[model samples]
Target chain A: MELLKQRINKDGDIKEGNIVKVDSFLNHQIDVELLNEIGKEFKSRFSLEKIDKILTIEASGIAIAVIVAQYFNVPVVFAKKTDSKNLDKDTYESKVYSYTKDKTYTIRVSKKYLNKGENILILDDFLAKGKAAEGLIDIINQSNSNLIGVGIVIEKGFQNGGKNLRDKGIKLESLAIVDSIENGKIIFR
Target chain B: MELLKQRINKDGDIKEGNIVKVDSFLNHQIDVELLNEIGKEFKSRFSLEKIDKILTIEASGIAIAVIVAQYFNVPVVFAKKTDSKNLDKDTYESKVYSYTKDKTYTIRVSKKYLNKGENILILDDFLAKGKAAEGLIDIINQSNSNLIGVGIVIEKGFQNGGKNLRDKGIKLESLAIVDSIENGKIIFR
Candidate 1:
């Protein structure tokens, strides 16, 4: 986590309105070695828990989840953000409000992917308003599956997403927690 | 390669449009052990070439490229399909046509990640129309980087992507090349 925070300080870009971009490693361009380390860390933390499947959202989270899934030795199901010709109509859907993008989009996973009494571990790149994570949790809840925990790479600590998940008694582990961005600088917790 | 073809035969879903969906273990739900095998296989094939970096596109390609990067002991730079807040303005962009959706989209790589004269190996999940592969090649061409080769997990041999790339004297290797699909049956070359 220290390494991630340091990398964020060195290469991360801070935009206005508290937008933090770690594209150099996290989003746009990826550091595979760092991702392997993160995977190991996640494996160490959640290895104890019985995780049936690893869940994440499409685009950003897929890379990290795929890396993490190696250690867990499980299959990864990424929730597609857009409707595709391939995805079945019978899907468990939920809406996520993206503060940065200023809109709500439906994230869906096929109903066949998640099942009853399965232990699910949700993973994602960023947890802001917790909408994305909550949406995944909502799908898992609908399936009558057990929501084991939520793992995130970066959490906007200033935002209520991480806090709300904690209040609801969901086990959340964010690798890097940003306390605030003071004067266009990052302050980590 | 035989294993991959066999896996495809076992789990891949053949749709009406010659679209084989290996979501169970390839794209939607990834198998890291299989990915590890793929990474090792890619390294074995491209071991002689001095690969400076591994390049791929977003979504499906990210997972394979990241895993393969470890074997090459290099970083991966995935092309962004959208110009998000995370990506910087300066980029090497290229247009890619998707056969699945029957649409074209622009993919961008940060000017920082890809450098001139760097040796890059393009990796992706499927090589159908080869638009994605060509798009990556275009970015590599623009950056003045040497495209060592292109790696693909599955190839629709009937589609002409691999043949086109090969015709241009480019090294394109597909793990499993499907000759045809008849009556929901896959015939591999």
Candidate 2:
């Protein structure tokens, strides 16, 4: 976590509307080395839980979840944002509102992927409003699978997403939590 | 490669319109172990080339590229399909026509990631019409980067994608090239 926080402070770009762009290393262009460390840290944090599979949302979370899954030795199932013809007809669906894009989109996973009573760990790159996390959780619940915990690379502490998940008694582990971004300076919690 | 072929023969769903769905292990629900093998095979195939970075398109390609990057010990940079505000203003863009989506979309990579003269290896999950690969190649050219080769997990050999890339003198390494799907039977070349 210290390494991730340091990397964020060094490379993360702060923009208007509290957007912390770690595109240089985290999301857009990825650092596999850093992701491997993140994987190790998450494994250590959730070592006690029984994680059958890792679930995430598409576009960005796929990289983080796939890399982190290496340590857990588990398969990863990503919820697709679009209704592609390739996707299965029977799926567990949830609606997510993206403040960045200013639209609500449906995220779905094939019903064949998530089975009942399977232990699942949800992972993602950023946790801001918790809409994406909530959507993934909804899909997990619908599948009748057990939600082990949520692992996030970066969390906006000023936002309510992290707090909301914690309130639901979800074991949320955020590697780096930015308490605030003031005048281009990122304050970590 | 044998393992991948066996996986496809066993779990790949042959749907109408010549669609071979490997969502059971490749894209939607990912088998990290199989992906690791894929990484090793790619590394072995492109072992002689000096790969500075792994470039791929977003969504499914991210998982394969990241896992493959482990073997190469390099970073992975994915092109964004949508024009998100999070992406940089200055980008290397190219248009790709998706037959499945029945539309042409622009894929963008930031100017910072793909440096001029850097060696890049493009990796992806599927290579059908080669439009996606062509788009990525165009971005690489715009950035003045060197494209060492393109690695595909499954190449529809019956399609023109593989032939087109090879015709241009590009090193194309497809793990399993499916010659044709004959009455739900996948014949690999």
Candidate 3:
């Protein structure tokens, strides 16, 4: 976690609208080494319980989830952001509001993937407003699966997502939580 | 790739339009153990070259690329299909025509990721018409990078994409090459 915060300080860029772009390592161009380390950390944190599968969203979250899943020794199911012709017709759908993109989109997972009473761990790169995580949780609930916990690489602590999930008694673990981003400086909690 | 062929035969569904859906293991709901085996196989096949980075497209390709990068011990960079506000303004873009979806879309890579003279190994889930692979090659060319080879998990040998790349003197390695699909039977080359 310390390594992650330090990496964020060294390589992350603070843009307008409170966006901390870690594209150099985390998202766009990935650092598989760091991801391996993060995967190990997540495994240590959540290794006690039985996790049947890891779920994440499309695009950014897919890379992180797949890497972390290696440690959990479970399959990963990524919720599709769009209704593609390739996707299954019978799916559990939920709407996610992306404050950054300023739009709400439907996220779906095939009914075949999630089974009743199966434990699912949700992982992602960033948690800003927790909208994406909430959407994944909604889909998991619809499948009658047991919500294990949520693992995040970087959480925007200034946002209420972490707080809301904690208030709901959800076991949430974020490697690096950014408490504030002021004048291009990222302060971690 | 015998394991892959067996898995495909067992789980892969053949649709109406000659579409071999391996989403059960290769994409969508991904099997991490199978993906690890795939990463090892890809490393064994492409181990002779010095691969600096692994590149792929977004969504489906990201999971495969990241897992494959673990064996190579290099970073993975996926081309973004959509221009998001989060993406860098300066990007190397190429248009890819998706015959399956019946649409053409632009894929972009941040200029900072792909350096000149770097040896990049392009990895992807499928190669039907090879439009996606061609677009990735175009981006690599624009960046002045050396494409070591294109490694495909499944190549439709009946399609011209594999021939086109081979004709261009590119080292294209496909794990499983499907020659034909007749009445739900997949004939491998």
Candidate 4:
């Protein structure tokens, strides 16, 4: 976690409206080496839980989930943001409101992929308002799967997403939590 | 490659309009173990070349590219399908037409990630018409990057995408080439 926090400080871009862009190494262009480290850290953090599968929302989360899944020795199921013809007709769906895009989109996972009573750990890159995380959790619940925890690479602590999930007693582990940004400098918790 | 072919035969769903859905292991729901095998196979296929970075598109390709990057010990850079504020203004862009969606969309990669003269290997989940692969190649060319080759997990040999890339003298390696599907059976080349 310390390593991730340091990397964020060194490479993360602090912008207005609490936008922390770690795209240089985290999202757009990925650092597989660092992702492996993140995998190990998540493994250590969730060593006790029975994680049958890792679930994530597509685009950025796919990279982190797939890498982290290597350590867990579990398969990953990503919720597709768009309705593609390739996707299964029978799916568990949830609506996510993306503030960045200023619109709502549906995220879905095939009913065949997620089964009942399976222990699931949700992993993602950023946790801002928790809309995406909430959407994933909703799908997991609909499938009657057990929620083990949520592991995030970077959490915007300034936002209420982390607090709300914690309040609901969800086991949320964020490697780096940026509490605030001042003069284009990231302040981590 | 035999393992991948076997997986496709066992779990791949052959639908109308020449759709082969291997979402169980390759894309939607991912088997990390199988992906590691894919990574090893790609490394062996492109063993003679010097791969500086692995380039791919978002959603499904991110998972494969990240896993494949481990074998090459290189970073993976994925082109963004949708424009997000997180992406840089300076980018290499290319337009791709999607037959499934019946629309064309732009894919962009940050100018910072892809450098001139860098050797890039484009990896993707599927190659039907090769529109996505062509778009990626265009971006690589715009950046003045050297495209080492294009690697596809499954190439619809019935389509002309594979032929076109091969005709262009590109080192395109498709682990499993489906020549045709007959009576709900996949014929591999």
Candidate 5:
């Protein structure tokens, strides 16, 4: 976590409205070496949990989840943002509000992928408002699966998403927590 | 390669219109162990080449590309499917037509991640008509990056994408080539 924080400070760009851009290593352009370390961290934290599947949203979260799945020795199921021709007609769908995009989009996972009574570990790159995480949790609940825990690379501590999930008694572990961004500087908790 | 072909035959679904769905392993639900094998295979095939970076598209390709990047010890830059608020304005964009979706959409990659003269290896989950690969290649060319080769997990040999890229003198390696699917039987080349 210290390493992630250090890399974030060195490479991450702090934009207006407390936005942290970690494209250099975390999001846009991925650092596989760092991700493997993050995966090891996640594995160490939740290795005891009965995690049957690792779930994440498409685009960004897929990379982290796939790498982390290797540590957990589990299969990763990513929620598709759009209903593709190949996606199953019968899907567990939920709406995720993206503050950055200023809109809500439907996230879906096929019913065939999530079975009843399965233990799921949700992972993502960043947890801002927790809308995306909640949407993934919603899909899991709809499928009658158990939410083992949520693993995040970076959590915006100022945001309500992380707190809300913790308040609900859902097990949550964030590698790095950004408490606030003040005067174009990132403050870690 | 035989392992991949066997997994596909066991779990892959052959739907109407010659679609071979291997979402269980390649996409949707990703098997990291299998992906590790894939990554090693890709490394062995292109190990001699100087691949500076691994490039892929969002959603499906991100998982494979990230896992594959570990083998090349290179970073991965996935092309964003949409213009997000976080994505840089100055981007190398290209239009990709999805035969399955029956629509064309623009894919964008931040100019900062891809550098001129950098050798790039394009990785993808499936290569059908090769529209997606072509779109990625266009983005690479726009950024002045040299494409070392293309590594495809499954290439629809019946389709023209592989042929087209080969005709263009591009180095291409496909783990499994599906020649045809007849009466729910997948024929591999």
Candidate 6:
């Protein structure tokens, strides 16, 4: 966790409205080695739970989830943001609000993936308003699966995302939680 | 490659609109072990190229690219479908038409990740229309990078994607190229 916060401070960029861009490593051009480290950290933190699968949203979360899946030794299921012709009809759907894009999109997972009573660990790159995580949780809950916990790489703590999930008694663990972003300054919690 | 085609014959669903859904293992719910085999197959196919980096588009492509990267022992740079606050402004953008969704979307990669003249191997889950591969090629061209070849898991040979790429003299290796889909039978070329 200290290593993550250090990496964030070293490479993260802060913008207006508490936005932190770690694209140089995390999302766009992935650092697989660093992700391995983050994966190990998540494994160490959530070792107590029995994680059957790792679920994440498409586009960005897939890489993080795949790396984390290596540690958990479980399959990775990514909820697609857009329905493609290739996607199956029998799917679990959930609506998500994107704070960055300022849009609400539906995330979908094949019903065949998440089975009943299976334990799932949700992982993603960023948690701003908790919409993405909430949507994933919604899909996992609909499948009657056990929610182990949520693991995030970078969290906007100033936003109510971390608080909202905690309010619901969810065990949310973030590697680096940003307390505030003021005038391009990043303060971590 | 045989394993992938075998997987398609076994688990791939032949739906209307000439669609084949491998969500059971390839796209939605990923089998990491199988993906590892796929990575090895890709490595064998593109054995001649000095692949410095693995480039792919997000969502489904991310999983295949990452699994393939392990075989290449290189970093994977996935193009971002939706530009979020986390995405860097200095990006390489390409427009791709999704025949599956009947829409066009932009894929962006941070400028920092892809350097000029870097040998790149584009990886994707499916090669239907080759629009996505062309878009990625366009981006890599714009970045002044070297595109060694494209590695696709499945190709809808009934469609013109494989032929189109071949006509352009682009080296494309698809694990399984389906020539026809009739009466729930998938004929391979």
Best by DockQ: 5
lDDT score, residue B19, model 5?
A: 90
> Per-residue lDDT tens digits of candidate 3, residues B5-73?
999999998987788888778778999888889899999998899999999998899999999999999
Q: What is the C-alpha lDDT profile of model 4 across A1-189, one tens digit per residue?
A: 999988988888877788988898999989999999999999999999999999999989999999999999999999999888788899999999998878899999999999999999999999999999999999999999999999999999989999999999999999999898888788889
- Residue-level lDDT of model 2, residues B57-88, one tens digit each, is 98899999999999999999999998787889
DockQ of each: 0.70, 0.86, 0.79, 0.88, 0.89, 0.71
TM-score of chain A of 2: 0.98
Residue A46 of model 2, lDDT score: 98
lDDT of 4 at B154: 99
Q: What's the candidate order when arranged by decreasing TM-score?
A: 4, 2, 5, 3, 1, 6
lDDT of 1 at B39: 91
> What's model 4's TM-score?
0.99
Q: Which lDDT tens digits does candidate 2 get at residues A122-170?
A: 9999999899999999999999999999999999999999999999899
Docking class of 3: medium
Summing lDDT over every window of 10 consecutive residues in candidate 4 chain B, give the lowest-scoring window. Answer: B80-89
Worst 10 residues of 1 chain A by lDDT: A96-105
Candidate 5, residues A1-189: lDDT per residue as tens digits? 899999999999888778889998888899999999999999999978989999999888999999989888899999999778998898999999888788889999989999999999999999988999999999999999999999999999998989999999999999999999888888999
Sorted into a CAPRI-style docking class, model 4 comes out as high
For model 5, what is the C-alpha lDDT against the true structure?
A: 0.93
Cα miss at B95, model 5 (Å)?
A: 0.8
Candidate ranking (DockQ, best to worst): 5, 4, 2, 3, 6, 1
For the predicted complex of model 6, DockQ is: 0.71
Off by over 4 Å in 2: none
Better of 3 and 5 by DockQ: 5
TM-score for each of the candidates: 0.96, 0.99, 0.98, 0.99, 0.98, 0.94
**Tens-place lDDT digits, model 4, residues B34-86:** 99999999999999999999999988999999999999999999999898766
